[model samples]
Target: MRAWLFSGLLVLLVGCATPAPDSLYQQLGGQTGITRIVEDMLLRAAADARIKQHFVEVDIVRVRDKLVEQLCELSGGPCIYSGDSMEESHTGLHISRSDFNALVELLQAAMDQQGVSVRAQNQLLAHLAPMRGEIIER
Candidate 1:
């Protein structure tokens, strides 16, 4: 009885202690701000030959707009995410962890270019951190 009671209390405490979702758009300035970051990030990603292969079959212009829209929605800005789910979008792409990491580095570089603060960066990253699991299939 005591052990069960202790477990219930622990669960309650954990639930109460959980923080709210970290919305990136609010942190890195706002709506227009995230668009600049996405633009820069895509540019950086395009410049790298290794990662560029992934975009060979893509429409770069559409990709950029979709990315901006997705980011805008993700950061709590007034926008909708029109892109497909991670599994659906990446299907047959064989994206590896290294490729994802490279893109992430480029993204961080772009965020830095826009002068996002450290705390905001971390919050943004944390918001995006879960996608890493869903995105890297290879």
Candidate 2:
């Protein structure tokens, strides 16, 4: 009877224990990984004719820093996004759907280059999808 009771207690304890799963931020490899992804995307964008013009006049370093912060926060990391609102920053940029799509593709390429899992990439894209309306003025 004591053996059975002990087994039951052990089972109960095990069942009630909660294991902490890794957050998306951790899956994205924390701040350093996010920084790498952002930098890679920016570099690709700079050379890609489809979106390069949009970045011609902007401060690339500031954009990179803000993108890193934004992605970090979006993925549940410790960083906070201190950049301007999507609409506020994108206003008057005349960004079209094609331009936005090109940027997204560049970002995806960057993530792929970093070996980020597709699941994590989709999750991050899902989080950012809502902001498309705010970013595309045309």
Query: Which of the numbered candidates is closest to the native, going by highest TM-score?
Result: 2
Model 2 collision count: 0
Model 1: lowest-lDDT 10 consecutive positions: 15-24
Candidate 1 stretches greater than 4 Å from native:
1-23
- In terms of lDDT, the best-performing candidate is 2
What tens-digit string does per-residue lDDT give for candidate 2 at 1-138?
999999999988865442224777877778888999999999999999999999999999999999999998888877789999999989999999999999999999999999999999999999999999999996
Regions of model 2 farther than 4 Å from truth: 1-21
List per-candidate RMSD values in Å.
9.0, 7.3
Pairing residues by index, what is the TM-score of model 1? Answer: 0.77
